[model samples]
Target: MMGTRRSVQFGDVITGMLVDGVDGTPYVAATLLVDEQLGVRLEVPYITTSDTAAGETPGEWFETKCPPKNLLLIALEGNISLFDCRYSGHTVRHPAGIAVGKITPADVVLQDRKGDHSDPLEVKELRSDIDGLTEWTGFTAITRHPSVDDENRVKKLDIELRTTDELIWTQGQADMALRTTWSCDSTAEGLTINEGVMLHSTFPAPVPVLTHLEEHRKVASLMTFIFGCPITWRSHSVRDQRFTEKRFSQLIKQNTVKEAARPDPTEKQLRHPLASPSQIGSSGLEAWAASYETWGRFIHPAVSALNSPRTTLENVVVNAAVSMEAAGHLIGEVDGENATYDRRRRKTTATFIYRCLARTGWDWSGICESRVGLARALAKNYNTIKHYGRGDFPDPLETYLVSSTATLVVRLLAIRQAAPDATSEFDSGRHFPAYGRLVEDFKNNGLFIKCDGLFAVSS
Candidate 1:
């Protein structure tokens, strides 16, 4: 009464799995085609992008859903390789990354079709006798099905592994694009209607200052040792040595760390009032990590309100609250030993936290004074906004400057609390001068009116 599924074997269906994410476009690769068995004629679209014309939205200049091409020339750049096994009657399990398992009847059979998807051609199985059948260049993805109902009826799932390293998606890059007009469009003789400026709501991550990244890396490395586990980061090298104490010791013994190549710190820089390595030891790092995410929520605008395209006063005020609460909590619990958060406005919290760090031998007199003023303003505004739901809206410039500086200050203070030695790594070719610079700027300048760059990113 029912037809048995041949393409599916051992709870695994390989033939009918390949599919596009949004459109359900069938994936018919050069060496694999299941359209006939799946009973679907795949329609591939040629997707590309170009400069937006006048009146077009920013980066909205994409050519999508174009007709299928005779052939797709993709340079996967060593990213498009997958392993499989073939069997006359049974299928094998998919192997994990970089592992070559023993071939049993071969895990899965691969086709070697060099023609287009729409082109009619006889299907042939790839054989060892074929020379180029071992390799292919195309998109790679996996599809899984999970039960969706009480009856355990399966719901098909899709995963897309395609990558895009092309778009700049930078503010300055988009700002530089010129507006184009059609030849037939003529200018009005009277008052010209100015085009309304389009704002970017998606907060693209900014690039990190190289110096801060260096310090953060050291702090992160020191953290792994303190936490007794590998820290998850945005990127990593193959077998990263920074997280491995043995490798770090080996590098230090060999004097191979590039940062350490610089002659010994003129005892003055190391012993500088700002460089007291004994200021704060690893006492509350665990708490810092646990609490960092709370304040971090405000710093990352996208996380705070994902649907919001642009920064608002609420974003800034909430961040201010986050910073102040964190500062108050740390200063009261750690420095004052009061066993609870002080629960004050940002200005008062900043003052208390600053004094707390100062008592611990941290030098903050060199910090920029303007930032303190902003903190005071943020405290006052945050109080009004938090309760009344009304305050000065934070423009992009203000959000980038004030929010970033405030968020960093609280986080850096926490890092210092977790591990003071995190400030410098004599063994590794790394230091925390950027952390020092930020401390100096925050204490001395406190200025947010001017910024050398739009924003910073971290790895």
Candidate 2:
């Protein structure tokens, strides 16, 4: 029996083995076939090493050719397992970002992390919380990329948000109609990718990016999206109008008495996107009536300077003062009797500006100082223009300082009106070390009488 078995096993083993002869030396290799119940596998069928000679480095360059680095994945029913080079198998990890569900083999993709990041980031949703994705016809996604050098170090990034659809939250279902887009493009001198700023080559960089100014625009746009204001290129200012209970009651009665008021069940209804402010150009006649007479005194110049540019710093100071005046009036307390501009010939004292701003919440320091600085410079430079006095012109630095300050105040006002809730944290109740520009609106009516000897003169 031993002799008969040996003869049969020898024939079978030789058939499975490979024999190679080189230089009178014969090398033999064999493939082992395991039963279904056995859990054995051959890791490296063959290894080639740089240190082939006995005197060479022992384990320096050993590599295997028979065992493969490639993994074979097989999916059956709802389970996926990976098979080894020797046909032994084990389960692999399920990828992230895919929701819990039976994954069909068709959904799998073969990819590695070696592609160029400069390419447009295209994302396709495989699974979503909201059902019927096609219903999101108005969906839009936007990404912004600022310039970054290859090393990816940026001075500061206020925001590098990767967003899909300013509207249409993934978890929430919404329907809205709005269409507007703006892009600015310019070469970045010192910029990079993702150590700070991410790269989006398709979406161009901001146009005419004059540094800090462009950053302001970016913040304003982000605020617009957050506050759910009209998604327009024009930054919408948040106007928080609150009326006291007594005042609200009075207003209701006054409207009712005026005879056009009506209470109707049919009138209380939801609005459609066709008439959505986001879709329609403007909020129409109703909104226009409440808006500024000339956009905004401060914002007008920022968007496009007053048609022709001013040549002098004196003009710049004066412009800042005027913008601050408009902005200051919107915030702080207002005198009911003198709500309108005072008719008397009196310069808007720094004290007056200060008082008005002091009423609102001011979380930032240096703002009042900025305003005062602007006002002081304006008063002096303004005297130069009004009296034709030879006064030193406001230097470029002073001009920019005051201008930026005025811009900040005006922006605050715009932001106050646009995103009132967000501004709550930065209370404008006037930040200190106090400045004289925080003045109350006062007027000197030029009404004075004097008695000289027996006669009285009134001027």
CA lDDT of each candidate? Answer: 0.29, 0.28
Candidate 1 achieves a global lDDT of 0.29
lDDT of 1 by residue, 89-184 (tens): 212233321111111110111221232333322211100110010111111222244547677766754432322221112222111111111112
lDDT of candidate 2 vs native? 0.28
Give the CA lDDT, 0 to 100, for residue 218 in model 2. 31
In model 2, the worst 10-residue window by lDDT is 246-255
What's the true lDDT of residue 443 in model 1?
41
- Per-residue lDDT of 52 in model 2: 42
Q: For residues 117-227, could you state the per-residue lDDT of candidate 2 as single tens digits?
A: 122212211111111111112332334455666788764435343433332211112111122222333456654332111101111221211221222233223222222
Report RMSD for candidate 1. 26.6
